[model samples]
Target: MTFAFDNAPVWLDLLGVFFFAVSGSLLAARKHIDIVGSLLLASLVGLGGGVIRDIILNTGPPAAFTTPAYLVPPVLATALVYFLFPYVQRYTSMLTLFDAGGLALFCMTGTIKALASGMNPVASVLLGVTTAVGGGLLRDVTANEVPELFNPKSIYAVPAFVGSAMTSALWVFGLFNVLTAAVVAAVVFAFRVLAWRRSWQAPLAVNGWQRRSSDPKP
Candidate 1:
C-alpha cells in the first residue's frame, strides 16, 4: 500500500531498457536505416515513455539524461543490432517477445515511480500505460505507421492497462512489493504473447462511410 520501493529489482529496469532498445533497433534494421538512425530509434524506444512519465511528474531531466546506466543499454543494443542486422532480421519473432517483455516491465516500474512521486492513483495508472507503450508509439510514428497500441487488431494497450490497474489495486490493498510487481509483469507479458499467438483483437465499429457506401441509394 505504501509506495516504498526499497526492494525493487534494479535488473527489472535494465531489462526494460535493453528489450525496448532491441525492438527499436530491429525496426530500424527492417527499415534499412544506417547506424545513426538505428541508435536514434534505440534511444527513443528505450527512453521515450520514461521521459514522458518524468515530465508529467515534473521529475526533470529524466533518468536517461541523469543516469549513465540508463543510457548505456540502448546504445549498446543499437550497435549490437546494427552489426547483426541480418541475423536479427532473420529471427523477427524475438522482436515481438522483447517488446512484450518491455511493455510489462515498464508498466510496473512506471506505476511504482508515479506512485512514489505522490501521484494520485488515476494519474499513476495512466502514466503506467504511457510508460509501457509510449516508446513504441514514437517508434511507429517515426516509421510512418500507425501505432500498434492504437490498432484495433492488437491487444497491446489493453494488457498494459490491466497490468497497471492490477499494480495500483495491489498497492491500495497493502499487498504490493517487488514480488507482486514481478508476478503482475509476468501475467501481462503472458497475456500479450498469448494474444499475439491467437490473433486476439479489440472490437472495432464499422466505419459510417463503409456502411453508407453499402446501403441502397435513398
Candidate 2:
C-alpha cells in the first residue's frame, strides 16, 4: 500500500485539478456570480474533493494546503472564466470532455491514494468516488441546487464508481502502475463522455399511486 511520490502522478493530478477548476468556474458563470465568487467556487470544485479525501485518510493538513500546485490552477482557471465566460459557454462539448477527464483521473488517483494509506478496498473505492464528485457536490450545495450525483437527470457518480472499482481491482491483482492507471482512466473518461453523448441516465423510482393519479382515465 505504499506509494512512491513520483512526478507523473503529481502532474496528472494537477491536470485534473485544472479541468475541475474550469468546470467550476463555468458553473459559477452560469449562476452569474462575480469574480470573487467565481474564484471561490473554482477552488471549492477543484480542491474540495481532494481535501475531503486527505482528511478521511488522516493525512495532515491536506495536500491542497501543502502544495501550491493544487492551489494555483483554480485561481488561473477562475480568471480565465471571468474574462471569457460567454466564449467558454459556447463550447459545452469541450467543457464536458474536460470534466470527464478530470473525473476519471481523480477517481483513479483517489483509489490509489486510499489504498496506499492502508484503507480497505471497499473504503478505498468509496473514497475514490467521493474524490471524483465531492467538488461538484459542494458547488451544488453552495449554489443551493440539488447535487447532480443525487439527480436522476444525468450519469455522474456511476462512472466514478466504475473507475474506482476498476482501479482497486487492478491493485488487488498487482496490475496497477502508471501505465495501467492511464489506461483505466481513459476507459472511465470515454465511458462517461459516451454516457453523456448518448444521454444515458440512471433510473428513478416511480410511485405507482402517483403515476396512476397523473394518468388520464382510459
Candidate 3:
C-alpha cells in the first residue's frame, strides 16, 4: 500500500488530540493529582492512540512525535486544564461534550489514515476503533477502573465504531473524498451528544442475573 500525506485532516486531528488531552488532564485534577501526573495522563491520552495506530501500520515514529504541532497542542491543553481546574470542575458537562467530539474525530481520522496507508477495510476499521478508544483504555487502567467501553450503559465505543464504519463505507463508495469522512465524524459526534442529552443506552439484560435458588447466599 502506498502512503500519501493528506494535509486536509491534520488540523482536525490536532484539535481532537488537544481536547482529549485536556479531558484527561481534567480527570487527573479531579482526582487531586499533582502537576506531573496531570501532564503524564494528558500526554498519554493525546498520543497513545496514534502510537498504537502507527505501530500497527508499521509507520515510522508516531506522527504525534514527529510533528511539533501535535506535541504542542496536547502540552498546551494539559497546562491550560491544570491551571483552570476550578473552572473545569464547574463545567463538567461541557467537558464531557468536548471529550465525545474528540473521540468521534479521532476515530474517523485514524480510519482515513489507515486506508491511505493501503490497509484492508477490516484493518482500517479496527485501527480506527483502536485509535478512538486506546487512550481511554490506557487512562482507565492507569486510574484503576474498568474501561468505559466494557460498561454496558456507556455509548462511547459504539459511537466510534459507527463513525469509523461509516467513514470506511463512504470511502468504498467513492463519495466526497475525505470531506465525506469528516461528515461521518460529525454524525458520530452528533450521535454522542444526542445520546448524552437523552441518556440513551444499550438495552440491559433482562432476568439474566436471577440468582440460582441453590446458590449459597453471601
Candidate 4:
C-alpha cells in the first residue's frame, strides 16, 4: 500500500536526520571523540533507526543506504559540530532538543511504515518505538555509555512510546495525514523535552511486588 504517504515531506525527514546527527556529534564532543568518530556516531544515530525499521519490515536495502540524499544531513551536522562544538558546548539543553526532535519524528514515521508493511497495530507500535530509540541505543553502546532508552535517569523510551501509540491510533482511524503526523510529532517533541526539563520519570520495579516512582530531581 506504500503507506499512502508517497508525498511525505522530504524536508521533515532530513530535518529529523539533522537533529539526531547534531545530538550524536554533540555526544562525541562530550566524550572527546575525534572528528572521524564524531562523523561515524552522527551517521549511526541519524540513520540507525530507519535502517532497523527497514530491516524489520523486510524492505529493500535501507533508505539511508539507497538514498544519497539521506547522507547529507549527518555529514553536515558532524562538520558543524566539529568546528563549533566549543561554543555550542555551552548550551547543553540543545542536545536534548535535537534528540527530542528525532525521537518525535522517527516514532511516527516508523509506526506508519510498519503499518504500511502490513504489521498489526500492536506490532507496529513496538517497532515504531524501537525505531525511535534504536539510534540512541547504538550511539550509547558505541560510546561505552548507558543507553538513554534504558537509563533509569530519564523517561526516554516512554515518550517514544507515546508518539508511536498516537501514530498507530491515528492510522487505525484514517486520521494519519501529513498535517496530523506533524501534529503528533510536535506533541511528542514537547512531551519528551518537557519530561527532561521537569525530571518526569516512569515507575520503577519494586521487588516484583509493586512499582514505585523515582524521585524527581529538584
Candidate 5:
C-alpha cells in the first residue's frame, strides 16, 4: 500500500489508528483469541472510530476505507501482536497505554476533521470525543468487556475533551500546526497515563457520592 497522508492531521489520524489497533490486539491476547480474532479486533478498534466520525460528518467515504494506507496499520499491528503474544500477555497495562496514545491523537485529528467539515466548535468537540472513544467502546463490547467510557472508575473521556477543546481553539485561532498538535497530544496522553497510574476517576451518579480508593470492595 502507498504510505502517504495529505497533511499532518491525517498522519496523526493514522498513528492514532495504529495505536488503537495495538490496544485491540492486546485485548485479544488477554482473551486467548486466535490470530484471526486478533486481526479482526485490531481492525475494529483501529477503523471503528474514523468510520463513525466520517459517517456522522456525512463524508463520502470513511478515510479508513478510502485510504489503502489506512488499512496497513491494523494488519501490521495484528501481526506484531500475534508474534509477540507471549511477552505481550505479561504486560497487561500496555493495552491501556496504547489506547491512551490513540485517544490523544484521535481527539485532535477528529476535532480538526469535524471543524474542516464545517462543524461548530461544540459539535466538533463532541465528535472529537466520539472519535477517540468509539473504537474502544466497540472493542470492549465485542469482546464482552465493559467499555472504559462507561466505567465510573475511569477518566477516559475527560482527557479527550480537554485535547479536543484545545485543538478546536487552536484551529479557530489559526494556531493549530504540528507543534501545537503535538503539545495537545502530549498533554492528553500524559493526563490519561497519570489517571490510570494514580487511579484517578470521574464522579459517580450522585452529587458527591463516589467510591473512594480506600473504600472496601463489595
Candidate 6:
C-alpha cells in the first residue's frame, strides 16, 4: 500500500515531535542543566526512537537528520520550552498531555513506516512500540535513572502497546490509509490520557515466594 503524504499525518508527526521535545527540555530544566544540555536532551528524546526504528528497519540515516521539518521542530520546541519554563512549570499536567500525544503519534507513524518498509504485521507493531517509547527510555538511561517503561510504577509501555496494536489491527483490516491513521492516532491519544487520569495499569504476577505464602500446600 502506498502511503501518500497528507496534511493530517504531517501535522500529527510535527506535533508529536514538538511535545516530546518539550517534555525532554522540561526534564533537563528540572535537573538544572544548561541551555545547550536542554537542547541536546530534547533533540535526543524527540528523535532517538525514530532513529532506532529506522536503523532496525534498515532505512537510511534518520529522517530527523535528513529532513529540515524533522530537525527544526525539536530545536524550536526546546528553545520555546526553555524560555517558557516558568509558565510550563506551573502546569506540569499539560506537559504530560503532550507526552501522551507524542506517544500516540509516534506509535501510529512507526507502524506505518514499518509497513512501508515491507515488514509483517507483528514486526510492524513491535516497531511501533519501540518508536513510541524508545526515546524516553534513552532519555532516562542518559540521565542515570531507571527507564520508566521498565519500572512497575510507570504506565508508559502499555499505552504504546495499545496504540500499536490498534494501528496494526486497522492496517490488517485494509484501513491502512490516511484516514485510518488519523483515527488510530486519536484513539491512541485518548486511551493514554484516560489511562493516565485513571491510573490504569497492567496486572503483575506475584513472585513465587510471595505466592507460596498465600497458598496452602497440596
| Candidate topping lDDT | 5
TM-score, model 6 to reference: 0.85
lDDT of 3: 0.77
Residue 128 lDDT in model 5? 97
Model 6 clashing-pair count = 0
- Model 1, 1-218: lDDT tens per residue? 44457446246667898899999888888888888898899889888988888888896888778878888879899988877877667676778888898999999888888887898888889999999999999988997777888865568998899999998888878888767887998999999988877778665576443323442332
Backbone clashes in model 2, listed as residue pairs = none
- For candidate 3, lDDT tens digit of each residue in 1-218? 21234774587678878877887787788788888898888888878887888888887988887888888866897789767777758876765776787788888778888888899878899899999988878877786666766655466788888988987777666663556756777788898887766656665577556544663333
Model 2 clash tally? 0
lDDT of each: 0.83, 0.82, 0.77, 0.86, 0.89, 0.77
Per-residue C-alpha lDDT of model 6 across residues 40-126, encoded as one tens digit per residue: 888888888888887898778877777789877778977787788887787767656877778988998888778767899899999
Ten-residue segment with the worst summed lDDT in candidate 6? 209-218
What's model 5's lDDT at 209? 72
TM-scores for all candidates? Answer: 0.87, 0.87, 0.85, 0.90, 0.92, 0.85
Cα shift from native, residue 145, model 6 (Å)? 3.6
lDDT of 4 by residue, 1-218 (tens): 22366546355567778889999999999999999999999999999998998899987998888889999999999999988988878998988899999999889888888887899999999999998899989988998988988776688998889999998998898888777887889899999988888877666666454423554453
- State residue 217's C-alpha deviation in candidate 6, in Å: 29
lDDT at 70, model 3: 83
| Model 5: how far residue 61 lies from native, Å | 1.5
Question: Top TM-score: which candidate number?
Answer: 5
**Sequence-dependent TM-score of model 1:** 0.87
User: What are the runs in model 3 whose C-alpha is more than 4 Å off?
Assistant: 1-5, 177-179, 203-218
Q: List, residue by residue over 1-218, the lDDT tens digit for candidate 2.
A: 32364554577678878888888788778888888998998889888888999899997999899988788999999988878877768777865786787899889878888888889999999999999999878878997777777765468999999999999998888888777887888888998898777767664576443323442322
TM-score of 2: 0.87
What overall lDDT, based on C-alpha atoms, would model 1 receive against the true structure? 0.83
